[model samples]
Target: MTKQAIEQTGLIPRSIIRTFDRFRIQLLSGTEKLVIQEFRISRYQVLVSVKCLLSLIILPILINCLLKNFLVLPLTTNFWNTHQQQIFLNSDQQNRAFIELSQFEEKIYFEFLLDSFNKNPAFNNSLSSSNEASISNQAKNKSPLKTLYSDKYALNKLIREDIQRKTSELAVFYNQESIIALTNLFGDVITFIIIGFLIIWMKPQIIILQSFLTESIYSLSDTTKSFLLILGTDLLVGFHSPRGWEIFLELILQHFGFPENEDFIFLFVATFPVLLDTVFKYWIFRYLNQISPSTVATYHSMIE
Candidate 1:
């Protein structure tokens, strides 16, 4: 029968024909890639691969460091110092700072009293003499005992002065932290911009890098892939992931000068991991099940 007549009869499935066409195109593309790769000198291939790796990995890191250290850090530090009162971002952050400072003040007060008692020579001598003295002698010496150390009101004043000092220190610490966080956020933004520019300018190199990475990953052993998959899923979406997510969210919020709201953190922890887990499961069911059933089976067995 003529091909046109057979097509009119619809004897062949359209899906099969489409799939065959796709396979043929992929085969031709792959053959072209292999031919190019084979014709290239080994040293040239290595150089290209190295260049791609450096652009993908080391270049971004270097740019981040340069921006953070040279640009963002000094600018943020100067701004934070100049506008110390404006550093907290909001009242909630300010409240948290004071709360932490109060707690620290209490700790310092207790430690200061203990240290004073331990280190005061007069107090030590009075204690030693009291142990040697009788009850009557102790009663006699009770009035003079007040003189053995600094006056109570004087100690209170000193404590207040120390607390004031600590308050200043705490303010400096908070400002420094805010400065660092701002620096990181700005550095990240600039680094992303630079990387985006690089990606656009070197599109061909980026494509080659992606293809190389995909081929390398596919060439990995099934057991290795399954192990990596299990490790990644567990780290991202398993039972303990909530704590990790909470910490990560807190850091992210702090990096952007936001208050670490417990409600927001908990909400994100509750939702994001579940969504991520769903995505992982969907990928496993829809793609991995077709591409590497054995790896999927291995993953299930290992997880179980």
Candidate 2:
């Protein structure tokens, strides 16, 4: 049934998929498109090299959407309707049974009162001091509802205790399938996160290569350089150590007794890699140009 539905209408259009592929290739290849061409490397190769990391991001989203649409919504609705109907019927029956029991208890209490009333007034006055004190306090209040509530409270306490004793019997009525389904959902999320972390940790170099491309055609402004460097650094962290680097930085700050939640400090920690990478790369580029200017010019010309 699911296959038929999927075949009838695809998730996304072919044209859109193609456009996305082209955009990713163009973005990642950067000014290195010329270099890639000179080296006879196919753009498809570039895409496939990072496909696992890309899948780590994409597959979970697709799975969540599919599960919610096909499994969770439909199965949960059907299960609720079927399971809850029986529970409600049993609850109503239990309520009726309790009401009958309460009525019988009230009749016995009323009979005792009448029997006591029939006794001598002197004998009734000679009751225990504790019992007499409680009766007098209740009489002073003069609220029938309060007296009724006191009786009902005792009945409710008994009912609660009964339920606790019969917990195993009630356990059989629970929806185990729903519990299992939710557990599986949680496991699926955990697996997704683990896969994401593994992808970053195992293929750090490839992920960095996919982040940015060399551009020798034009002189980039400081702001553009900073932005690109930061973007590349973010990609490096995301595809290398995932949240490990961020957590490490936060831990270090905490260890030094620095305020971990300060916005400026967090921003500085986040961008530190970008600053360091940019400076190091700039120095390398300058040194290479000084030592072998012709080679650098030739390489830039090929890229252009």
Candidate 3:
């Protein structure tokens, strides 16, 4: 039975018919416009095309740097300096900070002790000697050695003072890091806002840019396209991608001053890459297979 006859008989819903009609019209219109734009860009001079491509790529990057370094960073730094607070956003951050600080303190103390030992001639001579008994006797009798080894109370006081100093320094360091994180967050926000405005303002240029990129991609050899697809997929969603995801997640969390929770990081690492891999597979199956079946075949062979 014809769709029109079925619809007229009320066997098919009118809403479903309307929805499909609208979708069909929109899809055809969009595809026609895209094809026309591609043809138009293909008629441009080589120099004009290159200039358009370069400006599309470089201008946004340049603007992002200028906005971030000159505007966002300075403002955030000034505000942080004016009203500083040494605070962690959560208990996890606090614990992580102190654990890192403790490790740093241990390393510093160990280096200090090693330097002190190297500078002491008597201790060096005692260590160099093969006579263990003589070394023990010298350690007991020597005043310098006694001061270094036997003065537990003095050593404890020195360590206590150093710890207090380092604790204060850790607080200052944490405050500075918080400001840096805020600066990064604000910089990203401003950059995205500028990009959105540019997209609206330069709608024609944006269409030309999309056409340019599409033409460039399609012009490449099938092998090159396959290689690029393989490289991108491996980097983003392959077996080794979990470590990369972990590091990326950590940096993002630090940038937003979020607590670096291991559970959340692990969950993201496990799920996001699988989702991304599924997307890549779908793109390969849906678009690449239709557009260039040879490239899809080559990509599969390369994967094997």
lDDT per residue as tens, model 1, 1-304 = 4464222225675558879986787677577776566668544655676798797798999999988998889988888788565655556667877898788768866776777666565555655674555545655754444653545676678678877887788777777777887888889988899999988988887777676777678778888999999889889998899999999988788787777789989998999999999998998997777666678898888878
lDDT of 2 at 246: 67
Which candidate number has the best TM-score? 1
Predictions: Cα RMSD each: 7.2, 20.4, 10.0
Report the C-alpha lDDT of model 3 over 1-304, residue by residue, as the tens digit.
4464221325665557879986787677477787677677577634455776677668778987887789887888787777756465457668877898788768766866776677677877876889989788876876556656764565567677888887888777777777777877877788778778877876776676677778789889989999999889889988888999999998888887778889999999889899988988898887777677778999889888
lDDT of 1 at 260: 78
The order by descending TM-score is 1, 3, 2
**Candidate 3: lDDT of 304?**
89
TM-score of candidate 2 to 2 decimals: 0.25
**In model 2, what is the error at residue 106, expressed in angstroms?**
25
Positional deviation of residue 184's Cα in model 1 after best superposition, in angstroms? 2.1
Q: Candidate 1, overall lDDT?
A: 0.77
Q: In angstroms, give how far residue 14 of model 2 lies from its true place.
A: 42
Which candidate, 1 or 2, has the higher TM-score? 1
- Minimum summed lDDT over a 10-residue window in model 1 is located at 1-10
lDDT at 106, model 2: 66
